[model samples]
Target chain A: MPQGKPAVVPTDGLTTRQRRNRPLVVLHTGDMKGKSTAAFGLALRGWNQGWSIGVFQFVKSAKWKVGEESAFRALGRLHEQTGEGGPVEWHKMGEGWSWTRKQGSEEDHAAAALEGWREISRRLADQRHGLYVLDEFTYPMHWGWVDVDEVVSTLRARAGNQHVVITGRYAPAALVEAADLVVEMTKVKHPMDDGQKGQRGIEW
Target chain B: MPQGKPAVVPTDGLTTRQRRNRPLVVLHTGDMKGKSTAAFGLALRGWNQGWSIGVFQFVKSAKWKVGEESAFRALGRLHEQTGEGGPVEWHKMGEGWSWTRKQGSEEDHAAAALEGWREISRRLADQRHGLYVLDEFTYPMHWGWVDVDEVVSTLRARAGNQHVVITGRYAPAALVEAADLVVEMTKVKHPMDDGQKGQRGIEW
Candidate 1:
């Protein structure tokens, strides 16, 4: 409800237009749910603006399907058929790279995760999409499968106005410091605390 | 990243189906952006499952239009025309209730907020929607316009499986306690801190 000019005004001496045009690095991390949901929401906004959307799912099993993936894929098709919104590319590391790897092997998971990051890094370098959603990406970093320093540096040096959003719990301090916007989803209460399970439409 | 049977398994002896069937009261309260956006994302999920979607905005000005509103409305229309998704009803208290009230008067704003809440309460009683999004509703209670205790009691006693999501900053402690799910968006960093104003597609 507090409004007006924000307390942090641009001390960087950039013109208003320059400041407004800069791409952002957003981090959504914490124990609570909705981090990936919020990131997907942002992607929806970007899609409406004709921004190409790239969604990379890191840890979610291939057997699991979320509502956003279907919705975005449909929107992607809509864009293709009638040029309505924006294009969407959805990739799951579990299905894409880990299928060939041993299912429960830690080393195989780590390798697949690194491969996923490599692909994302390549996309960033090539400016492949307008919005990149690294869904549940913090796990690889937390598990030491991917290098946080490399991720930070690559994002910092990313060119153009392509926005990147990383969502997961236990985001590293280094990544938090590197992000332009960071939101921690603190858990005040959860139904699971009262022994309630997640519902189909609600949880996914 | 932590997964398995959630730590809080139902000690109440409720079946898994029974636990999943209970409706949720969710609160997204914080200073950071994306509270309402996340709620809209949930609405999108609900819509895909053929759930009626109700979005009520309490504090945002009528002139300010966010992308989710337009997107959800279009999806609603698509559902009607093609039998896809679900119905949507969006109402903004700023335009709907406060149009005749003095713009800057605190008392008038408070009164308008209460009237809006009354309408939502009525809808809840009727089980009018599958998902009710009370966007920025916390401001009224924070400003002492609406009674927080009354809101809590009404929600607790309400029947039916309709889910409710309330989003705003400064949510009352009592409301937090009553909610089945609560997520506090803690701000670690924001571009406004660097003096950048909200841009066209990204902000609205």
Candidate 2:
């Protein structure tokens, strides 16, 4: 016998109702050029769908040149382009959020980034209204500044309706294998390897 | 113009020479399921390519079920299935990790997970191998026990020369956006949603 209009049918480890858990999408990549642009583009689409999107630049410290921050931050501002309400908020280092000196031992940098991540996650969890993005997060891990298991576990525990995006290279195998989707950007060509250093606005 | 092999065209931010740097693959998901299986598969493939492979599972604590622990410890027993290695080395979590059950705040959990990520990242960095996998990382983050941003940054920093994967569910958006690959698994139909809960050997 079935109850009156059950929200979701129970199957395996998922419920009909729970199946509606807005899917957790994991995109693992190391390439920045088109990957970052593509991520921002997808984020914009998600925002249009009424998802609250959070943009988190994990490894690119706030101290980076203003040009770099602006370029990345502009991605978040796309919400405005959609004519959505509210503006993209930022949590830069030394501004409410804990700060990490750009120069430090691998351990120190990792510790500071971890602290930054904690703050970002807290804000994302509390917001609960849209999508959250953690940018350049894989940097510290690649450099041995953070723990892969702990980060993976914490991410798994997010409750309520929310979507998160983490960018950067060297994503731990644990994260990639567990992801529902994986888009690898194999470098086909670029101007950097030729000594064409990153330029403001264009390459930052 | 176009000197020295056409300026060493950069693909996805790396030159052909740098392409030697294995692309980092992150497998982030919830629970065991296909996480370990995928890692074993990748390692076997890389091993065939004559590339040294390293597998590291970030066990949050030593309280793993006896059967589960034994099974993981015996992963290398199937080297024949992989066809290229005498035995894959396994590094189980030691005293360098712990979970503070009493600390339930999101911040506390993130902090603990950050510590764990740092510890694991340290080991990964030392290896400098071609492929590495961080399993069950999302467990801590999902439980609010890890710093997601820190984990992402760490992964991004050491991406070059080493391909990595992170596995878990509820993957932070920052991770998905940062990754060169993004995979989303939708439980279109599961037994749990149909009333059949997890079964032994299958779900465990």
Query: Which candidate number maximizes DockQ?
Result: 1
| Shift of residue B162 alpha carbon in model 2, Å | 36
Q: List model 2 lDDT by residue over B1-204, tens digit each.
A: 011233444446755545433364444443213344334434434433434455444544333222233322233333444442333444434333334233323334455556657766775677556566565666666666666677677777764456665655666666665554333322322333334333222222
**What's the TM-score of every candidate structure?**
0.89, 0.41
Which stretches of candidate 1 lie above 4 Å from their native place?
Answer: A1-4, A62-65, A97-107, B1-4, B8-13, B62-65, B97-107
Docking class of 1: medium
Q: Among these predicted structures, which one has the highest TM-score? A: 1
Q: What is the DockQ of candidate 2?
A: 0.03
Tens-digit lDDT track of model 1 for A1-204: 224475766578789888887889989998887787788878877888888999999984643336677667767777887787788999887665433354444457788889889988998999999999998899999999999999999999999889999999889999999998888888878887777767866777
lDDT of model 2 at position A170: 79
Q: Per-model C-alpha lDDT, please?
A: 0.81, 0.48
Q: In candidate 1, what are the lDDT values of residues B1-204, reduced to their tens digit?
A: 224355665678778887778899999988887787688777778887888998888974653345676667667767787777778888877665533354444446777889889988988999999999998899899999999999999999888889999999999999998999998888888878877777655676
Using lDDT as the measure, the top candidate is 1
**Model 2, global lDDT:** 0.48
CA displacement after TM-score superposition, residue A78 of candidate 2 (Å): 9.7
Docking class of 2: incorrect
